[model samples]
Target: MTGQLDVIREANLGIIALNRPEAINALNLEMIDGITRALEQWADDEEIRLVLFEGRGPRGFCSGGDVRAVRQAVLDGNAEEADTFFAAEYRMNGIIARYPKPLVALTHGIVMGGGIGIAGHCAFRFTTSEARFAMPEAAIGFTCDVGVNFILSKAPVHRALTFAMTGVPVGAADALALGLTDCAIDPARRDAVRAGIAAAAGAARIDAALGALMQAEMAPVGEAALCAAADRHAGLDWTDEAAIIGTAGLEPQLAQLALRSPTSLIAIAESHHAARRLSHIGAVLAADLRLARLLCRLPDFAEGVRAVLVDKDQKPAWRPNSLAGVDRSSIRAVVGAA
Candidate 1:
């Protein structure tokens, strides 16, 4: 094990497990750098034909980047440290997306924020029944980064916007339907599946091996009730910006969005649309970098993180407290919208 990450070279498989179970394997900068280095080294390694990512602890595969530390950096007058962290994290996402070897992520439990960054780009994305997925950056007064918007954009526009704005978590079935995960295996079958993958990696039969697993017809447990409720609750007119604004209290999802930073909501919507048109993961990540640089410096980001993570208080005093109060033009500029 290396620091918070487990870097293992077994047979033809390179496995990296996030080892911070106590904190739900929340990623820190060291972990990001370590993952990047491993992936880079393995990219050219002839022996490592495939890579597998796992997360330690029962709570989830990965909760996300240590944004609490980012908040701390800003409070300590080291905002540049926060910037550096995001830059490196995004870089790692790119590396994983472009990896020459087939990459599989065995995501269980909570996969949020930075967790999605790593898992979402893999060639083979697997989840257990207990896995929950979300890109909850808006709730923390931040916009999506690490190319999450790219993943979200791949889903239906309404679903993407709702998740981005509300921070609602979806289960494995919803994830599969949304194209977030490829297969849902029984939690009890975790080891057998890992062994199967290892064998496939050794034999250079990755596709055939995984296809068998996919054909198991195992029923995906858990459903996205909240996501469904949100869809049923409202038919948002996204074309007209005004229709999406100032209606935060109209439904359950909107109520959650009401509690988030208004600026974050605007940015999420803008970025989601921008990502839809981007030609590739690299382009989406580049957009995310620009948006992250801007969002991290905003007052709402600090306050939102403080209220939600640091203080454990749900009350975040957003700078532009209402959606209508936010400047769409400025947010569009940051997200590269027309």
Candidate 2:
């Protein structure tokens, strides 16, 4: 239990380390502000050529946003707090996407939702063998946002759709295959790689330096396996919405979403399709804001959070309870109908 964030200015690297082991480094509004400030300052600093982010302990880099807090805000009738949080978080996502220098993200343990927003947009994304990654907003009665659709859009379309719809966890090897990560390495040599990155002063030198460090730990032992299920779905015709809806790869998550806010599932699906044709992540962010604003006005987001977090009871009696009956018109209201 170090501070929630440790902002260290090394000789060569600006380290924005997440230190909240207790909460698995789950981000809140204050931490988002700190990170945005750190990056904005480092973007202008001439001495620092690279920025690196990582988390502490074995629990992982980050679980996601502090949605429990957002749920609290909704319960208190202060909707501005949740809206403000999303605005700030999405802005931080933009900064990470357009960072001027080489941005390195070390992903260990679990990285989901906001965690992916922070690390996935970096120039160099490094994942340990133990890393688990996903965009799991569907399970929480929240639609996918934070520019994830941009990343998903650029990846293999069907595979990306499966992940967006389903909340399945992808391992380090699957991430590499999906082009989500630049390097996959054993968790043991991470500290050495960090030391080398922090010691180098030139941004141009990071490419080779990081590559060499990754090479040291690329052994076959304990490496994560490729996501065969996602691969199976990727080869299918995703244009058929029925195929996606009935995908075996998505079975586990389908059940979860059914018991959740089913309308959010529709929003997530539409957002993925909307981002598929866009070039910039800015468009994705805009769509996210639209969907988020509408979802906040709905009841499911709060009810889902209450059942999952506040009460510790896993039963969220969702308003339609099933996706079959949720109308497309309602889903469109969240994502904005084209």
Candidate 3:
């Protein structure tokens, strides 16, 4: 709507491109609304055969949500506004996840946070060699949301938890092996692929053909390191503060990742564990919303944002800097029944 998004019609296809190159195509409220509106309009359009989603810039598809704005809102004591934003954003994510039309997401470059929200739910998701993906909410002292709980739970056990807690980027091959991406295409072929979809017969036919094309182009390679890491940490009681930190001691990278935001890491571990037990999608989303609201009240969220973004300090003075310092009651407050 702000000219930050380009909606082009190619035969029977609707190509929705995020046009904010300056912010690496970050999803602001307007972009989210535009995408939601486009999907709703095209969902029932008889002529539209498929929806092709991509970001305009070379850096990647989308970096994530505009968290700097959300952080500023929190700093300005506008928690209510932030809550409304998340509510709308999460609703959009749910709609995309269950969209009626064929949705093909070309996810290249830095796909994180809200970027994941947009691309992760498509019927067909493709990644290029340059693509990097993650659910890095914990790094900024936030719980995973934007329907990430659903995505993570669907992933292999410890693989999901490790990704959530560590905020590490997974490459295209790793993503495919983890079921995070369906295909790995050379970035050069992106436009041709879009054109191919536009030329296809129908939405359903386009999706089926896309799967075949991906299978022909990219072969799946299993992620051994991720699998090994998961196997190593399985069944450990993450709630035991000392044990949680101690488990990271065996792996320096994991320790450093946990040290990035001890509070958020612990909170996410708890949130995901609780989410695993829920039987309904609505329940999982409600739980995530409740936790996000509570995150605004915590000091670490603000402190983490200031250190990471505002000050560019790269060091946050997280309260109780150690996991042992986190109170059980506070953890209970975040993950408690909604």
Which is the leading candidate under TM-score?
1
User: Which residue runs of candidate 1 sit more than 4 Å off their true CA positions?
Assistant: 238-254
Prediction RMSDs, each to the true structure? 2.1, 3.0, 2.4
Candidate 3 lDDT tens digits, 177-263? 556778887778777666665655354567678877777656344454554565688775655667667777886435656566777
Residue 280 in model 1: lDDT: 89
Mind giving the per-residue lDDT tens digits that candidate 1 earns over 1-338? 68689999998899999999998999999999999999999999999999999999889999999999998898788989988999999999999888888999988899998998999999888888778898888888898788877777777777777777778788887787667788888888888777877877877477777777666735556666655755764578643345554555456555666566778888888888988988888888888888888888889888988888889788888888776688888778867787
In terms of lDDT, the poorest run of 10 residues in model 3 is: 219-228
Please list the C-alpha lDDT of all candidates, in the order they appear: 0.83, 0.76, 0.76
What TM-scores do the predictions have? 0.94, 0.89, 0.91
Question: How many clashing residue pairs, candidate 3?
Answer: 0
Total backbone collisions for each predicted model: 0, 0, 0
Please rank every candidate by TM-score, starting with the best: 1, 3, 2
Q: Report the lDDT of model 2 for residue 146.
A: 84
Candidate 3: regions farther than 4 A off: 201-204, 219-224, 327-338
> Which of candidates 1 and 2 is the stronger one according to lDDT?
1
The superposed Cα distance between candidate 3 and the true structure at residue 122, in angstroms, equals 0.9
The TM-score obtained by model 2 is: 0.89
Q: Model 2, 224-295: lDDT tens per residue?
A: 333456564456543344554566436553333334366677777777887776678887797788788778
